[model samples]
Target: MAGKLSVLAVVALATAAVFPSSVSAQPPLPPGPVTMIVGWPAGGPSDAVARLVGAHMAKALNQPVMIDNRAGAGGNIGSDAAARARADGSTIMLATVASHGLNSALYTRLNHDPLKDFAPIGLITTSPSVLLVPRDSPLHSVRELIEKARAQPGKLNYGSGGVGSSQHLAGASFKKLAGVDIAHIPYKGTAPAMTDLMAGRVDLVLTTGAMSFIRSNKVRALAVAAPRRLPALPDVPTFDEAGLKGFHTDSWYGLVAPAGTPRPVLEQLNAALATALRDPELERQFSEQGSLPVKPMGVDEFWNFVRKQMPTAAEQVRISGAKAE
Candidate 1:
């Protein structure tokens, strides 16, 4: 028994020397420039946040951080690429509610598993949308809109940025919770939808940066799907306050690395991310874009935050009845 124990100890020592454990093997810097994958087009909010975060992370890592834009298939293309990346700390993804939450339920088949293929670094920000109508619309409030929708059914229509977008989900949730029928009009993008909403072509829209439009007297924000009244739009009531119990939705963005990354490396990345998000400059930029920072959290806490949103996203996908096979 003593001889056997000695042999086993020798084998373990050899393994440790040959393959440094995750703790000890962690590299101070990536072997190459780190790729930060953005699943959306350049110049959008997601891309802007990615570049800002990447700049700070580059400083922290002392390595060049590259932003790779692979916008397509409603954020699935880049998401799938990130999922297939090696577990080495070099490749990471800038994930959003669409990639990590909604797409799981929206697509009939996805190459990547949103929750399992990657490690949740941390949530960066969440942009809440407000339920809006034309300033001259006959509906005055959420209740009135619902009443009219129920009375006229498909006659009332709402426009969204695209099918399966957070905007679409918000509208679907309103229809489901209010027990009304509102036809959905899919647009190429939100700008056109907002244009039509102002032109009285669409009956309603859910807007994120409603301050300018509301201030311009172009749209009337009846209720918001937010935790509280937006400081910029104080008069807009929350869905809860507007009498729609438990209704909530937001476009949340988060950071993640491919699964199996070394724990020490991921910890460093998470720390860097948390620090960058708290920067005063980043805070000002987020506010200007109408995005609010998600509360700071450690890695484990951030996982919980990401996990908690999955079910809500699934429910929204179901309500939207959107599918991409």
Candidate 2:
């Protein structure tokens, strides 16, 4: 019995020596609420999607996720704030095409580099811009619009949310590919741009789906920028189908955290986002709003996609002479 007791004491000492309390310690994950910053104003597509996905993310994380809207400077102001945030994974930016990838080339001086300053979490959704004209306008199709624009260079004007926006890039790409010339008219937002297009103040607008005004015959969709037709706009032909090969551009939104965030934290967030994206109700809501829900890919894949797109988008900005305010 004495020998057995001594042996047990030796075993306990060895176990404690091998496994210290510090060896098992792990820093606690953010216990409080996480904030999602949307660069666009409320009631926009980005805001709507952020709120929808954020709710599910909150449930998966077992914490509340609040939305912060900071709209200005073509999404630069809010994006800069996100990039400057601490690398703690507590603050995330709901970044769009204008703020993340395109701004690098469009702006002469940026507060942050999209590729180096932020760690990509995952892609959320893509809202392809559609080319549209007034319903009563003589331009019946994309080809017709191009031909008219070519014949009357600088006579036709196109409306966009603003310079350096996805809308502007799409319009510029169309002009370059189709070999047409038209004046670009910049507006503060898509709503005002669409309004001007309907009022005949502008000849056309390459913008998001016009579902609300479609029923009223306010505008006519000429072509969709996606590879295939959207379900909501089945009658509209894609740019490739409309006689412009390899012409596709869309405003995509994704999740991004400040640079230097832990890899484990990013992976966990990506997994949660993937689960939220798989929800049926989320898909339905996105479709109803004329946006497509993109399945969340791994962090590396998301980063690769953004990196590959930067040069092409940058060249478009250069060619379009888009500038940041």
Candidate 3:
């Protein structure tokens, strides 16, 4: 009987060891606010997720969490800053698919190594891109839009938030797959670009965020650029359904710290992040915004996921000829 209890105790300790929380009286994280660097402007999905997770993490860790926006270069600007930050627990970055996966492939040169410069925390949320056109447009389907673009060649124009943005890549990929010569129109940001798209200034937009605009009858969603149709937009077909198979693209966000952050700190942060993400209210909030909260994965597992995604990202960048400006 005593031996069984001893074995059970060992098992308990081992399970608790997975996270740096106070399982065995482990020391708490060091003092001061934890600065979470978001690589996009506030109110965007990444920023919103960061704030939500940060709010929960602050309470769990008994430390304040601050959001610092360093928007530009398709998220590379803030990513570079986070990579160079001291290898301490005080600083970390909210990395998006653009920053970690696509930017490395899109740009010929980058100041920091996406894989080598950051310690993997875990994924936060994933939001897929959608195909949209002005509500009153005569185009009713992806096939029709493609036909028009091919028929008109460079006369049709598509708008994206900026160069090297995910929207740009999606549009580029779409152009390549659909064999269309639509002129690419780069906007300073998605807001103005979306405004123009709605106002018929641009023919189409490979937009992100929830399907609220679609539900509100503000825009017509032709297709979803995802592996499957979104539950929120069940009527919307995937690119595959539109005969543009395998044209999946998504905007995802994750948490990462400097590469050399102590393993214990990483474990603790991972714990706090996992806990925060699993919160019911946070999950609901993410869903309402067309973002899905992903479950927590181990640090190494997250790294492996990033590693596996590199080749595909590289191929997309090459095929799209997307480069940093």
Candidate 4:
């Protein structure tokens, strides 16, 4: 009995040494407010998600989470700032697919490395782009639109928020897969592109933030660029279902702190992010806006996910032939 007890005691000590309790492993953030940088203008999708998730994270961290918008260079401006911020848990950034995934492939020179410059905390939400046309337009389906584009070739045009934006890539992907020659019109932002789409100045648009217009019947969603249909737009068909077999694109947001932030601090921030995402009300709000929170994941797992997405983003950038302005 004594021998058995001794062996059990040794095993327990070894286990404790290898894995500490969560309560002791996580350290508190710095005293002042945590600034969350958004690499887009306020009132944009990334800003909206940051404000929502930051409000909930503030409750979890018991510190005010301030949103700082640093809009420019396709999210590079804010991302560069976040990459340079001190790694003391005082600052973080709301990263997007644009910043971490596509920009590296789109821009020839960047100040910061997407993978090495930051530590991924967790994914916030994903917004899938939808193929939209004016409600009163004669084209009612993706097939019709593709046929028209094929017939007119460069005479037809599609509009996007910018050169390397997800919208542009989606439209590019459509042109590649459908083998059509449609001219691309780049606007300052999606708002202007959407306005042009409605006014018939542009033939079509692929955007993530046009759900309200779809719901209000102002625009008709011909297809969604996702494997499955969105709950908010169930009536819409997937691109695959609409005759384009293997098309997909999404705009995603995630939380990240500067690289070299202590692993424990990263763990703490990820925990707070997971807790905030668990709020049923937050999930409801996200769904109402046609966004979906990502499934829970630990810090390293989230980083791994981001790493795996880079190659695909690069391929899309190549397909789009987009260059930074």
Query: Which pairs clash in the backbone of model 4?
Result: none
**lDDT tens per residue, model 1, 167-194:** 6777777788888888888665466678
Please give the lDDT score for candidate 2: 0.81
Could you give me the TM-score of model 2 versus the true structure?
Answer: 0.83
User: Which residue pairs of candidate 3 clash?
Assistant: none
Q: lDDT by residue for model 3 over 1-325, one digit each (tens)?
A: 9999999999989987775455344333568999999877665556677898899889878899999988777777888899999777889999777787888778889899998889988877888889889999899999899888878889888887677777889889888888889888876556667778878888888867735667788789999888888877788899999988888887777899998887788888889888888889888877766676687888888888878877877788899876666
- What ranking emerges by TM-score with the best candidate at the front? 4, 3, 2, 1
lDDT of each: 0.79, 0.81, 0.82, 0.84
Superposed by TM-score, candidate 1 places the C-alpha of residue 134 at a distance from the truth, in angstroms, of 5.1
Best-to-worst order by lDDT is 4, 3, 2, 1
Best candidate according to TM-score: 4
Provide backbone clash counts, one per model. Answer: 0, 0, 0, 0
TM-score of structure candidate 4: 0.85
Q: Write candidate 4's Cα lDDT for 1-325 as tens digits.
A: 9999999999999998899776566556778799999876665566678899999999999999999988766778888999999997899999888888888888889999998899878888888888888878899898999899888879888887776667777888789889989888876557678888888888899878676677888888899888998888888899999998988888888999999887888888999999999999889878866786679789888888899998989988887666665
Give the lDDT of residue 252 in candidate 4.
86
At residue 64, candidate 3 shows an lDDT of: 98
TM-score to true structure, per model: 0.78, 0.83, 0.84, 0.85
